[model samples]
Structures are given as C-alpha cells and as structure tokens.
Target: MENRRSRRAAAAAVALITALLTLVGALTAPAAAAPPPLPYVHGGQTVPTYSYADAVRESVQVDTHLDSDHDGKPDTVAVDVVRPRTTTRVPVIMEASPYYSCCGRGNESQVKTYDQHGTILSMPLAYDNYFVPRGYAFVAVDLVGTNRSTGCGDVGGPAEIGSVEAVIDWLNGRGTARYRDGRTASPGWTTGRVGMIGKSWDGTLANGVAATGVPGLKTIVPVSGISSWYDYMRLDGVPRATDYPGWLASAVNGRPAGTCDAVQSDLNTAGDDATGDYNDFWAARDYVRDASKVRASVLIAHGLNDQNVFARNFSRWWDALAAHHVPRKLWLHQEGHTDPFDIDRGAWMTMLHRWFDYWLQGIHNGVMSGPKVRVERAPRQWQQQADYPAPGARPVRLGLGAGDGGAGTIDTGRGSGTVTLTDNPNLTETQAVGDPNTARADRAAFLATAFSGTTHLSGTPTVTLRFRSDKPDTELTAKLVDYGTAARDDYLANDLSGIENLATRSCWGESTADDSACYLDTTEIVRTTDYGVLSRGWTDAAHHTGLTRYTPVTPGRWYSITIRLQPQDQLLAAGHHLGLVLSLSDEENTTPSGTGANVTVDLTHSTLSLPVAGATHLGTATTAPRLTGTAPAAPATRSTPTRLLP
Candidate 1:
C-alpha cells in the first residue's frame, strides 16, 4: 500500500514540472515583432511625431500563415499609441481613414485618392501629437486594407467597425494574450469610454461606427462626412446620369483604389441604380440623418462652399437629430469639401480635447453644457448661438423675376408675364476657379458671369419655384452671393504695392476684430466684376427636368422646379445684400464651369418660393431655451491648416 501511494505522488510531481516548463517557454519565447511598423513617413520625410499609427498597426499584428476565424487570410493589424495628450493612461481616439495618409500626393493623371477617403479630412489630421499632451491617445487605423493590414476595405458597415471595436476590446484586455493578466489588461476604467473622429471618408466611418453603440465610444466628430455613399456620391431620386465622374477620376484611379473602385465601378455600371427615387440603398446608409437610432453626442462641422457634398446635406441630419432629441452641435464655414476652421489647426485640436474630455474623461468641460451651435458668420466673422442661426433669423422670400433689369419683378400670383425657367447654361467648370490645380488666370473671369446685385438672405436659403420647360428636359444652376464692391482695380492703396499682389500673410483662421480693423465696407461694396471672392453654392435639376430636350414643348408652356442652394449665416455688410443667380444648363454639373449654355424662358409666368426674415415666418423655437449657462473655455483645437502649413 505504501509503495503504491509513493508512485501516485511521483506522477503528480511530473505533471507539475511539465506545467512549469510550458509557462517558462511562453515567457522566454520572443513574440514576433508586429507587422513591420508602418514607416513613420509624412510630407516626403520620415517623421517621428507622426508615430501615432503604431497602436493601430499593433492591434492587428499578423502571425504565422492563416486566420483562425475562417476569414480566408491571416489577420494583419497593429495599434500605435497616437499620444494626443500626456497621462498615465488616457482615452483613445480612432482615426479612421479610407486609405492611409502616407500616400496622398497627386498622381500623374491629376487624380486624387481623397474622394474615397474624404472622411479622413473630417477627423483630426496629422495633429495627433496635439492630443498627447492633453491626456488622450489618438490612433490612426489603416481600416481593413489599403496598407499592410489584412481584409478588404469596407466603407462604413459592420465588418470595418467590428474591426475597430476589436481594437477597443484589446485595449480593455479582452481577446488579447500579450498582457500581464494572462490576457491583456481589459480594464473597466480605460476602455469604458472612447471617442471617434474623421473627415470625409473617415467621418463617414466614425459616424457609422457610432451606430454600433459600443460601450466605450461616447462621442464622434463627423466633418464634411457623407452618411450614404450611394445617395451623396450619386443618384438623387432618379437614375444617375453617370454624373460625378470625379468619383472615379479623383476618388479612385490614384494609388490603390481598393473598395472605392468596387463601389464606384458598381455605380458606373449600374444602369438601374440611378436616382435614389424610393430611397432604397440610401435608407440603409443614412443612419444619422434618421436619428431615433443615434444616441451618442455629436459635433458636426461642414463646408459652406462644398458644392460637391453641399452644406445643406447637414440639414437633413440636423433636423432628424433634433426631432429625436439627440444632443448635437455644429460649425460651418466657407470651405470646399474640407475644414475651414483649420486656419488654426490648434482650434480643431482644442475641440477634440474637450469632446474626449466630456465623454472619456468624464469632465464637465462645458462641452456637454454648451450651446447647440456655433457658426462662422461669413463676409468674415463668427457667431455663437444656443441653436443654429439663433431663434429669430426670420425667413424672407424675394421674387427673382425674368430680367437683368436689376429689379426682380415680383409675381405674387402664377404666370405674371415672363418665362420663369428653361435650359441653356449646361457645362462643368464653375468648380475650378480657386481650385488651385486648374485655375487659369483667364478662367477666373467667366466664373462670376451672372453674378451681380446684393439680394439679402439670412439663415438657410431653400428656393421654391414655379415654371414650365420649353423642352422635356432642362437644367438649373444657382449661386448664392454676398454682393460686395471690388477691392480696387487701380491698386492705389495696396499694402504690397511695391511687391505687387504678393502680400505674404497667413489669413485663414476665424477672426472677430469687429470689422473696423478688418473693415469690409459692404455699404459701398459691389461685385469685384473681375476678382471678387463672393461665397456661393449650386444644385442641378436633372431629376426634375420636365422633358424638353429631344422632346416637344409649345411656345407657351410652363413647368415647376426648386433649386435649393447650400445654407449660410454670412453677414451681408450693412449695405451688402444677399443675391441668387439662376440660369439654364444642358449638361451634368460635373464641373463648376461658368454660366450661359442657352435654351429660352418666359419671365412673366414665373414664381419663386424663397424664405425671408420678416415677422410672420422666423422659425420659432419649438421649446423654451434648453441652453442657459456661462460661456465655457475656448474648447480644444487641432493643428496647422491650408497649403501653407507654415
């Protein structure tokens, strides 16, 4: 009996030794170095401060030969701790990009990869370093593909966001083996809150991910972002006319088009997927624009001059969110598919800090207690209101008669005596004037073609009209202008008179010096006629083109169309009035080309349904002021902006 017991004890000893050996092996074995760290490159140089992509690369680190979940290929991802602000352990910000920024230079074809990654421009750009000192660790993700990471690039859906959520999971010490606690430290504290950010491509991704309502993600800053690729990129309610080729020339074709090509190709070839008439595919992607589902706090910034994406797009989202009682804020400026607030990138960084602070740090930095909106009043100024346009903008409607007589005759009733609409001005070049890439000195002249008069406009402007087309199809182009006088053609008092028009000065950030020092004498302000920087936006009416072209139309016919210009809060200098220029076109609105394509029109029979700021119709506040508190600190900001990141 004694011998048998001794033998049993020896067997137990052998089992214990084997277990110890396995433990030592795990500790001593060198884990593979993560996917070769993404080369810290930026603007043609290997930058160290740009080391924020490290955590991103680490989280999806690749191993051996294959994936375990039956995903076809081995997973390759890594997470680089993009330090936003300094701290022992700080909240994380996921910088979602369609394609990595390491490759954004123009291709020989003049094509840009940005349109596909437009969301990236919406987030905190290369300013991750700014967050490091403020107690946040910003991360730049390579998405599913486009870099060393694995998996195909999915725009904004379950797969891509699930990948991101996986990263969040790892931070909290879940599903990870490289940590002190047998698994990585899935701390309840750190991963309890996370924030999302992106511009354009990244912006859409951030907003999409927020829909998942991950426990850690509490806020998202979606700038110039699109909610639905199908709706925003193409198809407005009818079959698309293979319209925005820019999606291919500028968005895809460049470096490695990736999934963008798949999406765009699908559109280019989809003969039946034309307009979003019934909202089919659009309904699936437009989440935020239909809010009962979105509960996270949001800060939306948009580009007023964004004809491509259109500033008014945010309107759909704002209105929907308001209805659902979702907490939100906004900041719009005169920019094209980009951030105008970036004049002072730090200002962007500042906002990021505050947002993350409120949601992640649980700090009462006033972001949660601040106004519902803060907008940049154009013609050069900024304003803050508890809500957008402040409760008393008062909608004003001024009739746009059929004549260049400087006085738009009002037709209170229908068919007064003029041709209100027709088709003539159709070409794509208006979007190229200040377009840095193709701005011919001469092309600048034709841009302000029909631009004259200072018709006043406040708040958001939506033009409702009544008309009949002389043809089955007709096009309309409208530009909202702040009519101000030319700055001076003779160059008499030019500040750089000696050096010509080369006045070297950094001028982009928001300034509120009372217009006295920066006085824009709008009273005497008139169109520059040749080189005025008038703010404007446009929309095409192909969807509502009531059959005119290749078809038949009597001499005395009529049609109905509504051209809604982008919204604005521009301050018309005291004497300066807001104006709208309407004309006909025969082609797609692919280019921002100037007016005058020609068909014909009957002025007397036209009517316009515009909004004015009078006593009867100022959009009334639906409820008592929900905002009442002292102004908070100047919110956190981002980094340097413009072509002169100087």
Candidate 2:
C-alpha cells in the first residue's frame, strides 16, 4: 500500500508540473490575439452591430492651403464628425456644404447642433443615425466662408474646391487638422476610404472635389448638382440672373457683413454678366472638363423637371463619366429639385446602402450587376434600363410649315413661307403658350397631328432656325409642349420644387434626445393641366456663333442658329399632339433684352429634331388644329414663385 501511494504522488507531481508549464506559456508567450470587432454582414448588407447611441461625436478644423479671406492666415474649414465607438477602422461618408448653417438641410431644414464644448451634438440629416451603427463614419463639413470656416466664399471657385479637398487629404493622413482646443486632430480609427453625397450646392461641392482625383475618395452620389458654374448662371450666352454669384455668396455666408465684400465683388466682375461669355473664371469651375482625372465611382440622381439645376448638368456629367469608363449609376426622377429619399424612401435607402457597402466597405453586394439606370417613368413608377437616351433612340427631323393664323404644321415635308413675330419682353410664358391657334403677334406656334402610336422621347431636342432680327440683338426662347388633359407631377407647383411637406412625420434610424431621426413626410404635388411644358431653351441672338466671345449682330442679317432644349424622358400616348412654341424673351427664366426686335423665320430652312425612342419616323401630320376662343385659365395653385437659388 505504501509503494502504491508513492507512485500516485509521483504521478500527481508530474501532472501538476505539466499544467503549470501550460499556464506559463499562455501568460508569457506571444498570445493568440482576440479578433478585432468586425462589422457583421447578412444578406449582402452590413448589419447594425455597433451601437449608434454610443457613437463618438466630435469636431475638427481642417487646414486648407488657401487664404481666401486674406487675413494673413491659412484658411480652415469646420468639420463635424460622427463615428462608431469601436476601435476598429471604418470608412467614411461625407457631405461638404455651404447651407448647413444658413439654409439648413433636407426637407425639414435640420442644422447641426453643438454642445458646450463645441462638439457636435446632432448632425443635420439621418445619415449619421442610420450609418454610424453600421460601422461607418458620417462627416459634415462647412464650405469655405460658410458656417465656422475662416475664409471667403469663392462661389464654386478654387478656394471652395480646395477646402473640400483638404478634408479628404486630412482623412488620409496627408493633410493637417486640429481640435477646438488647438490640439492636433488625427483620424486614427479610419480606414481612409470615403464616399461623398449631397443635394444642390452640397452635391455641387462633391462633384468639384471628386474632379480633383483626390485620393481616399471612393465614390460620390451627387443629386441635383451643378457640373459647371457657368452653365448654372448662363444658358448658351444669356444670363439667367444679374449678379447671381454675388447674391448667392452673400446668401450662404455666415460671417459678419463686409467680411467677404472683396470676394463677392470679384465674383460679380469675373462672372461677366454683361457679356455672359465663358472665360477662364468659368473654366476653373467646370468639373466636366476634368472628368478624365476622376478615380471615384459616380452615382448621379437628378429630377427631369429640376429647372433650378436643370437636367443638362447631370446629363453632361454622366456623358463625361462614361467617356472615362468610370463605374457609375443614375437615378432620374420626375419631381423637380427634390431628393430621391422624399420620392421613394424605401428604394432609395436600399440602393444607397448597397452602393456604400460595395464601394466603401468593399462588399460584393451585386449592386453593379443590376441595371445602370433607373428612371421614374411616371409618378412613383420606376423602370430599370441598361442605359439612358433609351437604347434605340434616334433623331427624327420635322420641317416647319406655315399655316393659317399663328398656328403652323410640323411634318417630314418642308413648306414654303416666312413667319413673322414681334419681340414682347413683358409677355409671360403662360400667355405665350395660350390657345396655339389664336394667331398671337408675339409668338409662332407649330403643332403635329395626333400620333397613331405611342411615341417615347428620351434625350435632348435640337431646333435649327434660319431667321433675321430687325434689331441688333434679341433674346429668343423655344419650348416643347405636350398638349393633353392629364394628371401629371406638378413640377411647376410647390414653389417649383415639386414637393409639399405633410403634417405627419416618419422616423428613419435610431434617435437621441438631441437629435431625432424623424422628419416631416413629403408628397409629390400633382396637377391636371390642359397642356404641360415638356422642355425649353433660351439663347442670346448675338451668341449664335459661339459662347466664348460675343459677335455683334447686324440688323436685317439672317443668321442660322441651333438651340438645344433641356433633356427629357417622356412617353406620349396615342392621340396626343406635340407642339413647339417660338417666342422672344422668356420673362420667367431670363432677364429680357428688351430689344423689341421683329423676328422672321424662313419655314423651309427651319427644322425640329426629336429624340424618339424605338421609332425611325414620327409619321406625317395631315392637318393643323385651330381652336376658337381664348384657352381656359389654369386652376389656382398653392405654388410660390420660383426662385433662382436652390
């Protein structure tokens, strides 16, 4: 029995020694590290694993290389940041804007709120609340000369573009920044991947910044944004508004009065409202020219009826991006100057989430495998297509034929005659388009016979006119009209912005006491009018040759000019007629030249080009319609007067 006990004790000692050795190895040897907290993925989307309520909120001042305000110091832009609380690195979604403090953001006009320490307590939109918990950071940056940034507003010039570029550089560790207390600010927890997004001026900044080919910027979603400042202020060679740049700069600047007087003055001078010519000043702000340098993928959203920014901005940028073979997607809605979120919340959110996941988080969400374009064919009715200008669109040319009264015929065959109309600067568009058969002295109206089959128009229309003006200079307007009684999205209603806020509210993401994710619901304004304006074009007769320089027009000299109307995607039902109205001085969109010139058009030399989809010909018209008596006035609406500013 004693021998057995000794053997057991020896075995116990050996067992104890082995266990201690293992413990020491675990404590002293290189430990097997616990995996870092990674984002969770399910159904091809990043799930909310991080706590949004516990997200880190902070502010920093990014140092820009410009002294736009000329205060003997380098300019700085204000940046408000909200990030997940995890220690793991994450990508960023940024929106740089000039409207954060003054005009506010979104349908509810939510602005950033601050704590006593100047830290951001609440961000303007639901982007932070919705994206933070998904392991992504949301950043709101003030453009130069706006909000707390120390600089002058350059009105889409170098200073504004550079300021935004500086922030992206800082995120990638190539630029400098600091906290409110003057301590150095470092984005140590970020992976340096960024995706930008915004609407109006905010989205304009995104387009400008992405054109710089800035590193660390992965993608951008520019909604109703301008690609060229010159295009925004001028069409062809006619100024949309006088001193527009200065007025806009003053409107958005948060600094004290006279702080940016010199800058604003320079903006007005360089814009050259008198000549309305494209100069070096305008070239610097044209992002479409630099599209080849863009490395970030682009996702564009614009309203077909967005007169504020116009459809050409997105269409031109889309074409430039395609020329470079950049990864891209497009969303064209029916509402005017409105967000897709307000148009179709669920679908927009889903598409946005997937886009960010695939581009920013490197997730294979198959978003790129879907259609490249999604257009709202009708109110709340979306159609997916492979490309825009619809795959089979072809231009059909129709010759103008003078008929009895002011009305004329449009068909494949040309007619002989000279049509004359006097310039009336004070005439409104409503009066110009009224009763096409009335033989108005100030406008010439032409109509096509009822269509035998449904016809679709998917691109821009061009009108070529050989005409003579009695005066030295005149402003001309061309409009494409759809004459029918039908319910349509009232882009002309709701202050020309195409939406009305409802009393009810809807919540998007998690909320805090300081910031709620609920925003006022919005609905599309609808109106059933006898006729709808489909597209319009404006031009200065002196700019017939080029937009770069002004050529004086000699009285009685016939000039051939081509005007490109705004882009459109419309489906004309059978039995509906298409009409074209040519008039002088669109009082609604342009400042009248007041030349009062008598314009004469040779019908045989003028033609209208339509981008008809899936059709080789528009089919000839038999006769023009002439309705008697004055047309009925449109019903009264709650729409406010349209403004030039977005």
CA-lDDT, candidates in order: 0.44, 0.86
- For candidate 2, the C-alpha RMSD (Å) to the true structure equals 9.0
Worst 10 residues of 2 by lDDT: 633-642
Instruction: Put down candidate 1 lDDT per residue, 290-402, tens digits, no spaces.
Output: 46667577788876555445455666677776787777888765444554333334465566656666676666667767677766544234566677655656655444343
Query: lDDT by residue for model 2 over 90-125, one digit each (tens)?
Result: 999999999888988987888888999999999988
Candidate 1 accuracy as TM-score: 0.62
For model 2, what is the alpha-carbon lDDT of residue 185? 97
TM-score of each: 0.62, 0.93
What count of clashes does model 2 give? 0
